[model samples]
Target chain A: MQRLFAIIGDPVKQARSPDVFNALAAERGVDAIMLSLHVGAEDFAGVLDGLSGVRNFEGAVVTIPHKRAAFLQCGSHGRAAEAAGVANVVRKTGDGLHGDLFDGFGMVNALRRAGVEPDGRSTLVVGAGGAGVAVAFALAEAGAAPIQVRDRDTDRCRQLVHQLTQSGYPACEFADDFQGLRLVVNCTPLGLDPADPLPVAPERLDPDCVVADAVMAGRATRLTAAASARGHAVVPGEEMLAGQMPAIWSFFGLPGETDISAAKR
Target chain B: MQRLFAIIGDPVKQARSPDVFNALAAERGVDAIMLSLHVGAEDFAGVLDGLSGVRNFEGAVVTIPHKRAAFLQCGSHGRAAEAAGVANVVRKTGDGLHGDLFDGFGMVNALRRAGVEPDGRSTLVVGAGGAGVAVAFALAEAGAAPIQVRDRDTDRCRQLVHQLTQSGYPACEFADDFQGLRLVVNCTPLGLDPADPLPVAPERLDPDCVVADAVMAGRATRLTAAASARGHAVVPGEEMLAGQMPAIWSFFGLPGETDISAAKR
Candidate 1:
């Protein structure tokens, strides 16, 4: 029987998760289809209740306003989600719904694929929001040393650093200088608009640094574009999306890592 | 934005509505998809309540064990559904969910396509199930006189005749003979299994009659095969299914009749 999967969020019309997964499923001849559902916060509980009746319904990618709410709905969360306090992917388990935080793992996976080892490297993570927090935790968990967590919001930044320190991860204070940092990531929404200033100035970074942007653009973000021009190995947002799918497919109970690029054929 | 349509029933795995409508939707470049959902009896009420929260859900084809249950869910029924007290299709209108019966319309529409008229013709309709009753009502509405409705369950059969007669139709007693009847229809489950008897023996039918079997077969049912062998103009079950699509597409708020065969290419 064909199984149904969905991406649930308020502004789901813009989501390409369906296209991404559907292309892979069709290529692999898997009996599955994923669709985007524009479910608002107000309708979240009811939608979950209704999905109980949808026997073939597998689960969903919870985004935006529903990520935290999805975590609350699940029976349990994976270590990353429990630590980060949010869920980006949700799946139906034999007992009930299960959730996991994949942003951190996805970014690490993307970097690792590009031949960058996160361990024992000094890093500057720019953002105190969900993605930034996940990135910092992943970097810390991967044995990176002296990880700096920065954000425009001081309270959120303090909270993230505090959480990492309390959890015995290698999170630390921000270094005022970024002259020789091995890794730098823009987890903030700064890269979405070309007019916005770069999360970190191009002149201040090491030319040998590995830079990544969480926000997707039509092409490379201003930060990534500048980083690439400076002769640094820059990872675009698309790579992060691709890296995320393997983890998502596992949560969805499909057999291991999917090569989404090759699956397009 | 993409719209979602579904077929709701307990035993819906065999339903071809998704295949039929999805083909047309893709052919016309309509931003719509039709999927089958298996909603069981115990979960019916909750499913309806929950669907109200499904923002992209447009409509559904309500099938077996749920048709009459669907009538109860509708805010109002169209003429045919009201007359038959059941609905095979439901659409989301601005005000609420509205329903209509298409089985009767489908039969009349099918016969008309084949250049056969039901008005002023004597017809024998087999079975007293929902489909049979709807067919009889449709025939009566189309001006078929002295309609004979028969079934093994006499009370249910008598009840159908009473409803038609009380509602000002020309329905009458079922006759034991079919020698001069202009049209003969089998709306029963008899033709599905080869071992089951035909609704009406082929030996009693007039050689000039137009015979139709509502139950589908891999090719032709024994009754249709026999009728064709005897030189009677036999309408296969496929035509009835085709005839139903116009009504279903209309209910789903799409434009005009769908040529399902051409859509496959």
Candidate 2:
């Protein structure tokens, strides 16, 4: 049977998951395609209810504002989703809809792919929003110690730090500076506009530090470009997206990356 | 913005609308794809409600057991849908979801395309089910006089004949045989199994009569093949489906056939 998947968000035209997953499905000869469904916040519950009735609707990549709503709607959640209080991926199982948070895993996996193991590394996660929270928890789970979180919203930043500490990652704290950080990830939207300043000054960071930007753009963001210019190992937002594809694909119980590659041959 | 469309039915895997509409959308650069949604009768209402909430969901091709349900759910209907009390297509409008039946028009159009104008022709429609009713009404509307409808279920057959008569198609009546019929259409599931007998005896019909089958098969239906073997004009089920594409596309307010060609160039 041909299965259906969707990447659902309010303004869904900007989503790349449909293209990525659909291409992978086609290449692997999987009888499935991921579509971009533009569903608003108000319609989320109804849409979710409706999609559940579709027998072949196997999974969905929840994006943007729907992630939190998706997390709330799931009957069960993975540890990553529970820790982040949000879900970016959802799959239908015999037990019902299962949700998981993959943003942090994606970032961590991307770093690892770049030969920067997050385990035992000092990391700074900028922005206390959904992405930052997810990344911080993921890194913590990966054994990264002394995780520092920063955001313009002091209460939000403090809340994340508090959550981390309460969750037993006692090394987590609120950061005021970039000192001694080996892995610095900007989870803010600062680099979306060319006129915006870099989330953090690359000059203040050590040359060996891995600097990553979460703001996806057509080309390198200002922070990524500056970090690259400073000779620091730079990971753009696309890497995080690319890193999550296999994770999400596996979460859906479709073929894994290795299986897909084998199938391709 | 990209739009979404779906063909909804219980066993939707066999539906060709997705391939047909998706191909048309791609050829016209419409930034849309039609997916097959398998929703059982029990889930139809919830699914329809969910689909309506989708901001980019422009329309759906209703198939099988859901056509009448779609009709009942629609806020408004076109004349064909009203006449048939069923809808094969539904489109979103500012007023709400509007539905229309194109099966009848499709059959008539297919016949016209094959150089057999239905106007003033005496036609016999086998089976008084959804497809039969739709085709009979469409043929009547196309000026095919003295429409004769037949079915094993005498009650159902008489009910359809009554509906046509009540709707001012007084020339319509219950059919007992192929006598005096200039055109004959098989609207039942008779041809689905190769072992099943033909819906009508092709030898009993006039040599100049036209034959059409609504049973979609991998190859020609027995009735159509036998009729064609006897030198009668025959229209296969695929032609009915092909004929409806432009009508359904136009109903959705998408680019028309001529406009699509112009855009393609």
Candidate 3:
């Protein structure tokens, strides 16, 4: 029997997920298919109920807006989802829906693939939103030491630092400055627009640091470009996107096998 | 900003929706993305509620197991969705999820493109499920007369007849035989398997009849193959799929604006 699958979200036009998963499915020789679905905030409840009763479909990935909403829907969630209060993947089980957040793993995978070790490293993260929380958790999960969390919302920083420490990340502190860090990550939407200001000044960045930005739309962010000029190894958002697929595939009970180099070719 | 979308279903991996919609989105110069989401039956309600709050996604396409569920989830349904008791498209409205069934339009569009006029024409449809309901409605919408509906479950046929008549169709009746019909449509899954029996006896099919099957997976069913041998004009499931895209796009408020053909190339 053929297995069916779909992604649910509104404004579903800009996602690269179809190309990404379709290619992976074809390579795996699974008789499964994926599609784009549009659902608005008001109708999300009905659509979710409608989808579960449908016989053929097997899996789904929850995107923004829905991620936090999904955290409450699933019967249970992973630790990351609990801490971050968002879920990016929901797996269908015989009993109920099982949800887990993979955004943090995506970042970890990206950094590992780039030969950057967060363990025994001092890292600074910008932004305290969903992406920032995931990135901080990932850095902690990978054994980053003495992590500093920063955000325009100082309260958010304090809250995240508390959560990070509780989650067993190394000693955490609140810092508004970018100094003496082996790595830096920007998770806010600040760099998405061309006119957006730099999350951090270039002069404060360590030339030997590895800089990463969670913003994905265009070529390079002002932050990453400046980091590149400083001779720092920079990781692109696409790298994180590519890195996340394997773990996501695994979470969905898929084969979870993908060769990033081969895919790029 | 790039738009995001998802197809919500259980067996999401098997859907071809992502390929079709993403291709169209690319051709239309719309910065949109689509993905497949898999949610289970039990968690449908929670998941739907969660999705409604997502900020980036605009719309989604609903499929099997979810169509009827989607119908109930809609804050409001169009005349078509209300009549069919199902929905294939759910768009986010300012108020809530607004649903409309496009399968009927797809059937009508396919027939019109193939130069098959249903007005005052005699047609026999061999299924009473969702696809059959849509086709029956489309035939009525096309002004067909004396449309015959048949299903293995006699009650379903009677109920569908009642539904169709109430929805303003012209004289729908139940017929078990395929004799003296100008057009024959197999809306059931009977002919999907290559080894399955023809939905109707070939000898009973008119030589000049229009035969159409909603199956797209493999070669033509025995009925269509035999009908073709006898010089009948055959409509494949692909035609219905192609026919539906324009209307589906239109439902998303994209309409003829999406360049589907160019994207596929």
Candidate 4:
């Protein structure tokens, strides 16, 4: 039987997960399909409960408002999600549901795919949402030190920093100091629209810092474009999505699927 | 977002509903996918409840043991399913789930497509299983008076006759008499397996009577092959499936899809 995979989120029509996943599956003969399940936030848990009846429903990728709620449904969590207290992936194991966060790991993998590592690097993340926390957790795991987080939601920023500190990483507050940073990541939706401001002042980014943005669709966010113009290495969100698929596919036990970045199908 | 449709049954993998439905959807540029959901009879209710979580789920096509059980979940029943007390199609409408059965209607349509009409014909349906009952009901509705039904299970045979009689159809029990019959249909699993016996004795069939088998996997079952070898016209189960699609697509509110039999997609 063909397996069913779902990406559940409110307003999920914009998510490119299904586009890339389905293309990769078809190109590689995976006999699988990924659907963007635009479930309302209020119905997230009820929907999960109901999905138990779908015998071929292998797993679901969680996003946005449901990230935290979906995590509660998982019986186990990967260390990355455990540290971040957020999940981007959920798998159905024989025993039960297992949750993991891939956004952070994918970012690190994207960096490696781009020929860089987080060892001894100073990093700044501008968002305390699920993606921001995942990036911070992954950076810590990759040996980044003194990670800084900022968000318009001050409480969320403080909460993320506290979560990072509890996870035993050398963490600090973002004070707009990007001069000597080796990496600068934007986890917010600051550059999603044409009129939106960049998450940070692109002019302040150090020429050596590798700039990355998690908001995809636009491909080159203002921050990345400006950083690229200034000769700084830039990582696009699309690359991160591709990088995450290897881990996500492994979670689905379909690891042979070719990388979407390489397949481009 | 792409809509989700499911075919629910224990042995659902072999059903060609997904193949034709998905093909029609793709051919017409409709954003939809039909999945084969293998659910045990025990879990049928649970699965239907769970499917409620799928916000994009439009409805499901039911087969075999679960058809009657599924109709119970429908808030309303279309006239055909109501008359037959069974549903092969369940659709999500603004009012709620609406159940309908197309097997009978499809049989009549298939006969018409094959250049034969059930009007005023003497019909005998072998096997009083779901398919058998459906064909008998359709024959009755098409004005085949004194419709005959036979089954290995006498209770079921009696039950279907009673149901048809209650629906104001001229129905009776099969007395192993096929003389002068214009139509003979095999609706049971007989001739499904190579070792299984033919549903009816070909020697007893009138060479001028039209024969049909509702089991399609083998397309030409022993019953159909024998009837054809004996110089009788044969209608394969594929026609029944094709005839059913028009009603199914209309139930899904996608009536513009050309007949899949004509499209052969």
TM-score of each: 0.80, 0.84, 0.63, 0.83
Fnat for each predicted structure, in order = 0.60, 0.83, 0.12, 0.66
Per-residue lDDT over B1-265 for candidate 1, one digit per residue giving the tens place of the 0 to 100 score: 7898888876666666688788787767888888878888877657766676778988888766687888888998988788767788888888878988888877887787787899988898888787888889888999987788888899988998998899898786686877678898898867677887778887787777899877755477888988888888987665665678756876788865555344323
Model 4, range B97-117, lDDT digits (tens) per residue? 888888877788888888888
lDDT computed for candidate 4: 0.81
Compose the digit string of candidate 1's lDDT tens values, residues A204-229.
88778899887756478899998898
Candidate with maximal lDDT: 2
Off by over 4 Å in 4: A111-121, A143-145, A151-169, A176-178, A188-211, A215-239, A255-265, B113-116, B127-133, B143-146, B151-169, B188-204, B207-210, B215-238, B255-265
Give me the runs in candidate 2 sitting further than 4 Å from their true place. Answer: A113-120, A128-130, A141-145, A151-170, A188-209, A215-234, A256-265, B113-120, B151-170, B188-210, B215-234, B256-265
Error of 2 at A53 (Å): 1.3
Scored by DockQ, the top model is 2
Ten contiguous residues minimizing lDDT sum, candidate 4 chain B: B256-265
The pairs that clash in candidate 4 are A50-B50
Give TM-score values for chain A, per-prediction. 0.82, 0.83, 0.83, 0.81
Tens digit of per-residue lDDT, candidate 2, span A1-265: 5889888886666667777787778777899888878899999989988999999998898876788899999999998788778898999888779999888877887787788898888888899888888888888999888888888898988999998889899555555566778989998878777999878888889777899877766488899888888899988876676678777888898874633222111
lDDT of 3 by residue, B1-265 (tens): 4455556665455556667777787666777665666666565555555556555556677754577787888899887888778887787788988888877776666777788887887888888887788888888878887788888888888888888788777656655556667888888866656788787776777677799887654467777788888889988765665667756676777635644343333
Q: Name the regions of candidate 1 deviating beyond 4 angstroms.
A: A112-121, A126-133, A151-159, A162-168, A173-239, A255-265, B111-121, B127-130, B151-169, B176-241, B255-265
Please give, for residues A1-265, the per-residue lDDT of candidate 4 as tens digits. Answer: 8888888876576777788788777767888988878788877887776665567878988876688887888899988787667787888788778998999888888888888898789999889888898888888889988799889999989998898888798887888777788898899977767579878887887678889888764357787888899998999886776678756876888757435354333
User: RMSD (Cα, Å) of candidate 3?
Assistant: 6.7
Better of 2 and 4 by TM-score: 2
